[model samples]
Target: MSRKEDGTLVLNKTKIFDTENCYIYQRGGTESKYWQFYYWDSEGREGFRIRKSLRTKDFLIAQSLAQREYINIRAKIQNEESLQTLTVAEMTNIFLAKKKLDISSVPHAGITPETYRILKNRCEKLNNFLGKDTRVDHLKRSAFKEYEQWRKDGYGGKVPKTKTTIKTELSTFKSIIQDIAIKDKRVISNAPDIPKITIPPSEDEHRRNHFRHEELRVLIGTINEWKEEKTLRKTAGLHRQMIACAIELMLNSGIRVGAVRKIRWRDIRVNPKDNPKQQKIFRIITIPSENNKTGKQYECNCEIALIVEHLKRISRFNSPSDLLFCNQNDGKTFSSRIWADCWNEIIKRSGLEEESGRRFSYYSLRHTYATVSLANKVPLQLLASNMDTGTKYIQDHYYHHETEELTEELNPIKRTRKMTADEMLAQYLPQKI
Candidate 1:
């Protein structure tokens, strides 16, 4: 037996080739008749041994297999490729496991549980589309070209998915490949190119379902009536008040429904000034990273201090740590079913849905806020920051063509002919009353 400087033990056992560091040998015992390929890799500071079964008893066949693998490994090392031989399924699993760890290790910068579920679903779709056994390194750019159509057709089902839904799913799929190949360095090759989905413009579609001012007034009126209804149980009344608070916060602050559901009393901060109006006018609301979809903590100015005061006056769970909108009996967040039922009832009673011919959800309040703010000429950058989104998104989704209300601004009188002196004087100067 001989030992190398790199700590590689050279056994004076069976050797098929005259290679110093790499060789093929067979171990004695009922370890079977299979030959083994052994290589001592000394590429890095710490050397390691690589061993694999050639799965053949014949010396020539084992020699051929060993040589081929050795050459391939050397070429990979030369190209600086990853040594991991992961399939699509294996890569997806690894990505998910890392994501799960990220949730605990870096909650502020990690994906939320809801986002995890969504990513898992997208990964399943990717696995189904491209066979799970497909090697990550072998993936080609052309493989994703038809994915949009395949996903849209609902995998040959009856109901086709919308382009918007397909676009989001494709984004998640692309992110998965990028995360594994580029970010994690798990693939031998660079990340494969994914085709982008071009979603057709759906201008004013978001605002169409949003509550108009008249509709909002009607909704508030319905809420006032429903919350104070005499037939409601004590716990039920508490729930309604919390729902009202949630609606007002979303309407005034443009906060997402999901983030609103997770708000705690301590998450809100009021101005320290003695002025009551100033305190109510300038409240800061913090959306925790775990509560929001983006997984990034941010604070936005909101005038919901008065509403918070009202909730504090009536809420059973008013402790700083308790959720502001929790169930009075158990201090738990309201279930999805409870929220949906209340919102549907509110819509049914408001009668705005019948008049407007559009359905409204909790998210409609946030949309309403954006639409109204844009109409009031709020700057795109300011509104985007308030909503924790991008200016381009606000411009694209909230820009409505219905500028009839702004006729004075959108289409001022254009003088094709010379204006009369009296007309010019009247337009330019204010007349004495």
Candidate 2:
């Protein structure tokens, strides 16, 4: 068959489906003209090909039916596509490609950059367990447990992987396999069911506490010192300075690292709602769904205007296309995922690297922001909205009051500009709605 430039398809002898290895056939003698469409049936590998009768002696009618059936097969292959069609490795690659696409662009399923990193890691685990080339349709659904056990055994049962770790790996494996499988009906049931492995509460990692004020101070001061030191000593300091800016940004506004890394100069506004602009206070940072984890674009009133100003002044390129905190060495975007060396090192240097107590990472900065904001009586309802997190989460997790005396320092006498519910909706929402 030939595909015309005007997008019309022309039928040719023998082959009907362009993508598949399909062709027309006839019984015994050519004179009989009992035409039939013979195509390879991949439904299971039990049979080599399926023979379907076009039920017509007329050549034109047989061609028409062949085209119709060919189209139907092509649609199924398309819907169940795995590049050249239905193999584990090709499908996994496609799935990861889609996730990376979602991470970089809009109209995504909210897979964060961190989540994409994890997905790739999970794919590796699956490949190690089952060879990447294994046909997805060939596996028995119950064999998932055999995989769970195989991971639990962990290479001849010597260096046993953690129960939590093994569970996560197999569960992710099952998810990727099942997602591709049943979406196009590789199996009968509501997807091939993977048996649930019990993850005991005792084995779960605890929720973290926010960084102490002193720890935050030390970290920031140390980073600032790194930035100001002499030229030779300040080589590594450039990256640290970027880290400090990222910390300050997240500390004032609870935007995650995944979202923060994508923020370009064009996304910021220095108090656009205020006349003459208030440089002393936080302005605004818009986190759109393409970068943000929540998959929602929203405004954040943040004190990072000063920080942003400093960054632009020091930045090699201050154009709208340039990122806020890029790699100091190469001026490229940092991190395959968060927790670049500087963050962990700084936390360790700050002496916040706890052995048993609450641990702090780059995410701790966000938690610290929420904790400190709540302590300042920033209004819990508004804080949750501003953070783009749940009010219930704030109440349950981050609402521990530090001290009553510390709260008195704010002295509610000074007027503050906080957006009311109606005002917030008016600003963030489209008026056409």
Candidate 3:
């Protein structure tokens, strides 16, 4: 079979439904095997056309599939629907690519990488429940309501999603459709409204997992021991040291992992008035807007200058431009896998996982900082400013720790000495007199 100038084979050309504009054929080159269908839509949009694979080799099956596609296209045109077709998964990929680029190029104006990670997870869940292949234009508002039910029904597991979790996921999914698919890409005509989820009062008060004082001691000790292992290779030992420094930095400064990864040596400044050896103002860490989760530049007085000094001594890439926490091999920031694996191993070795009865991740250090600060009577506004969050958030999430710290003060039992049972009974009987 000879190929046409457009690279399509003319040998397999067959007109469908005896129409001049519609036909089925095979292409040359890499697309030579599968049969394809083409429809010139003169009635819909000017010069509008559809070219898709029938995904079949047999002429009979190709003919059937092409006819079905042609009918569907014609019906969509008659109903004044969009001819552009994009699958849910394809739309999500496009949105995420643009989002990632925005985060890198305009970090202050865009969402944080941590927030992007959560959004990506929600999009994955949407893909799984609604199907990856489902067309964006074909989705109805009712599908989202069905999705709410599907999530409530244990999501095909023993534990169902909480109302708050479902609400957030649905809200994110809706925003992706409205902001990305419809408004940005113009793939879909309109966005479907997601059904509202009724979130009840949360039963679990302690949402943020944090390390106790003893657990922190054990964790730091474990990190120290892990880094000093005699069997560790040079590069491995250096990497563990970096991890140790990162953990201590977070515990001391309450900075997020995302922000910490972007830190450089130039961001640190020693207080001129205070001595580095014995000083109240040890060092100031300037978290730039681009690196911060809240996208605001702020300075924190931290006690991790010694840790930074140790890192500077060990690291070969200790230049001002190099990342503070980086891989020794490439002088790049540690990969997520490496950071997570090291954290998990440290937690296990510390015995904090079993002793604390909580799942501890890198973020737990931040929570621990908040709880400890609250316990130490750090003013709410000041702590919030230092942590790059609002006072209300701290009060809502971490106030329980403060209450525990003031247990005796908040509920004092006034008794000079232990009274006998008869004295207690006499006080109750003669209270009116």
Residue 92 alpha-carbon offset, candidate 1, angstroms: 1.1
Which structure is stronger by lDDT: 2 or 3? 3
Which candidate achieves the best lDDT against the true structure? Answer: 3
Cα lDDT tens digits for candidate 3, 1-433: 6676676555568999999889888775574578888888776323566788888889999999989988988897778687787889998897788788765524657665557777787778888887999988888868787876787676733344356667778888888888766776565666887887776655244567788767778888899899888754689888988888899899888888888888998998887877646564367889998777676899887778788888889998888899888988899888877888898888888887676555678888888888888877789999998888999888776555434456666653753557778988888785665
Itemize residue pairs with steric clashes in candidate 2.
282-302
| Residue runs of model 1 more than 4 Å from their true location after superposition | 1-16, 24-36, 39-50, 53-85, 104-108, 133-142, 156-161, 178-196, 203-210, 214-244, 256-259, 268-306, 309-315, 327-364, 373-402, 407-433
User: C-alpha displacement of 95 in model 3, angstroms?
Assistant: 2.5
Q: What is the TM-score of each candidate against the true structure?
A: 0.62, 0.61, 0.65
For model 2, residues 1-433, the per-residue Cα lDDT tens digits are 5543445343443777454567765654235556777676655444245566787878888878988877776686667632223556766786788778777455355565667888886777666665677776556656566766776566423343346666676667666766665554343223345767676665563444677777677777766775566665454566666677887888889888778888888898877566655656677888887776767888888878788878876677577877888865666887753346766666665665553344566678788888888767799889988988888887776766567545456765454758768988888777693
Ranking by TM-score: 3, 1, 2
Summarize candidate 1's per-residue lDDT along 1-433 as a digit string, tens digits: 5554656454434443466778876664344767778886666434546788889989888888988888887887788765556788987898898887766423457666657776777788888888899988877778788887786666723333346677777777777777885566545445666777666655225444677667788999999998888654888887888898889989989999988988998898975653776885668889988777677888878778789889989887888999989888999988877888999898898888678766678878887888888888888888899899888777776666555567766543742557678988888897689
Clashing pairs in 1: none
Best to worst by lDDT, what's the order?
A: 3, 1, 2
Q: lDDT of each structure?
A: 0.77, 0.68, 0.79
Residue 246 C-alpha lDDT in model 1: 89
The residue ranges of model 2 lying beyond 4 angstroms of the native Cα positions read 1-91, 97-104, 107-114, 133-166, 182-195, 200-208, 213-236, 272-278, 288-290, 328-332, 335-339, 347-354, 357-359, 401-433
lDDT of 2 at 294: 63
